[model samples]
Target: MSSTLPVLHVGFHKCGSTTLQAALFGRHPQIDYLGEPREEPRSTEAIRLVRDSCYVEERKRIRFDPERSRALWQEALSDVAPGLVPVFSKESLTQPEFYAAPDDPNLPERLRAVVGPARIVIVTRHQIRLIESLYLFHAKGVHVEPAQQWLDARQEEMHQYRFHTVAQSFVAAFGRDNVAIFPFEDMKTDAKSFARRICDFIGVDSQHGADLIAGERRNQRVSQRYLAYSKIRKAFGLYIPIGRMMPEAMRRSFNEFVAGGREARIELPATFVAKMEDYFRDDNRKLARDWGIPVEKYGYPV
Candidate 1:
């Protein structure tokens, strides 16, 4: 048996991570894709603490102890099976708090300590699309705020869209040779090919390509009508009580009624798109210059 090389997928969420997780988990014999470290007790307690700390909205409230985290990591990986590469994936690792340079408070350093030297994979989406998707995601979770209002409230926290800064931190901690960046656009354009590339990156067999490609699409957007209904329900703070009272079947029927046999597409305002492009222009340029990513592929102004 050969030794395992740990690979971490620190996600910039809503960037096809769910699909990638579904593809890699148990599909390949050579890789052990652990979806979230906190889900299993085999992970070190320190690692769990670090993961949970980054997993919340109020990350500033969470404190980390590095010495304890390192000790726990050593114990956790001490018995990892030989010849199988361990893949740890979690989207929260890309949160903005972790990238707030100089003031990052060593969050990224703690992550490196827990994981040791490992391959870091990050998937990024166009900022505009990502923000819109994020808004819809919150709406689904009963957040009633309008898009602009919600974005304004959380703008500073949405630094996952600032790819260059996030990438630089990871690269600085983990080494540039150890990191790989793939655009989410690639996944949407050719999922099979994208899966193949990722499989190669993690030293998995591409024979599982069919299984990887077959993974179901997750977090599909709800129709605009359904989203609007969710917003209204949330605004009234009625979804909770109504949800409790409604039978599962009734809830499904209600969804179907709102969907009206097809999902309604939510269109973004052109002005908002233009603003996002301008906001992210410099960061995207840095990504192009430093990481050699084709910013044009994301439709960013170069």
Candidate 2:
């Protein structure tokens, strides 16, 4: 622990977070990045604590110990070089509950306590696309919920996707100058510039790792066969890890028979998108007016 930490990239998921973590931050020679286990090569105890602690289980919010988190962070910083700026990135930091008006907003405050006023970076995308992509992301796993129900549940959490609200909360916690927001659309359009901008903001060398993060679209494609198989698993009340038990040969044959190689054309209904646009119009208008960002050009509702 030589100096105060610099940046915290608290994510609004379904953004290019995985690619940024795996390719840009993970590979950057100067930045000392810490986050999830598999996504980060240098998964320290501090990150595990952050990821494990903040969540709701069985209608109860899990507690996060600021002192313990700081202690673990101190221990984790032992390996970092004196001059390197330590960056903590976890896309799920602003957990789903934070968006609800009545819920206690402890994550940002807890983070302030643990790290003490660091720069906060929020990377988000268009609301309709964000929700649609999120549904597909869950479809990859044991999630068998009907897409309509899943999307409808999330539509209620409009504050989460408002982008400006979440950004302003961090700005409230950590001073105005410390918060920066960017669109994931920029990364998709120009990977090099997008990576460079973030690297520059974080005070790291941007020239080194831009190309590594190009063209990364993670888990947006849903498999039709898997959707059917997953529903059947749900029908039988099997929520456990039963996929491993299926014989590899049988799995391969089933995939061939079902033509699971083809990506399913899953899409959100136009009415849902229109509702989201109408809901977020005012918020997006405010975001553009305050931030001077051309959100409309990137398909955001203005």
Candidate 3:
């Protein structure tokens, strides 16, 4: 409450980041939203910098240049919100190599310069479902291989990523008191309370955007058929506007077919699930100890 606010929603993406951003940051009267929806190679510029110069050679070069990225990020915020507290949401902020060395001379200082004394909110999901949704999301565009195949081939790479390291980085930069960790599942069910917590964090009143939260998760499901259809449409020029021209019943049938065929239970197979769980176990444990976030809140037994 002492000064202006900036809350960075460094995401463990596909954890309803879109819905939460839509309701809280996207439409909030007090918050300004940044970043492009459906932007791939998310935080592309920042990732490139991290990969090329900052990261070790053994590490994959899939990161951005944080300094330039945040400069542009802040510029985007200045353009959009003018005088308000800026709320930036980007899933790429959780990248392990990027966050691991917060004490490093270069990156952390750049982060501190852009969003001074910012409150960092990290939204995470159960690992099993999170990775699965991510696989589907990748299928939508980011990947050519099927979900299972990506898992099989990239298991070590995926598992080696210590996403929870971002929590430590934020705590190191902004202090533990400024960090708010929440389960995306809970946020989906009780957005008002979640929003209130965030409002309190940013020193904004809940009434600033309480009414706008009503339709938060309206687009929660996408059927596999629709995803496939979308890919076909993209190839053949059957766009959404064209789909809108079709009879409503026909569109509904198409959507339903995708939902029926593509939707899978969030549960993953045992070995695949175990690999992810074992990989993050220590990182999550360290996060809990450092930040007092309950290990149980992570949706897997520690």
Note the residue pairs that clash in candidate 2.
Answer: none
* TM per prediction: 0.83, 0.79, 0.70
- TM-score, candidate 1, is 0.83
Give the range of the ten consecutive residues with the poorest summed lDDT in model 2.
36-45
Clash count for each candidate, listed in order shown? 1, 0, 11
The C-alpha lDDT values of all candidates are 0.70, 0.71, 0.60
- Give the per-residue lDDT digits (tens) of candidate 3, residues 1-302: 22366677767667767776777777766665554363323233443343344343445544444567656545544454445666667765564444334334334345665456777777766666677776666655633465567778755446423545655556777787888787676666677776676677776667665556655674465575656665676677544534577799997875566667646433456787776778778877765776565667547535
Query: On lDDT, who's better, 2 or 3?
Result: 2
What's the lDDT for residue 239 in model 3? Answer: 45
For residue 224, model 3's alpha carbon misses the true position, in angstroms, by 6.3
lDDT of 2 at 113: 73
Q: Positional deviation of 15 in candidate 3, in angstroms?
A: 1.7
Judging by lDDT against the true structure, name the best candidate: 2
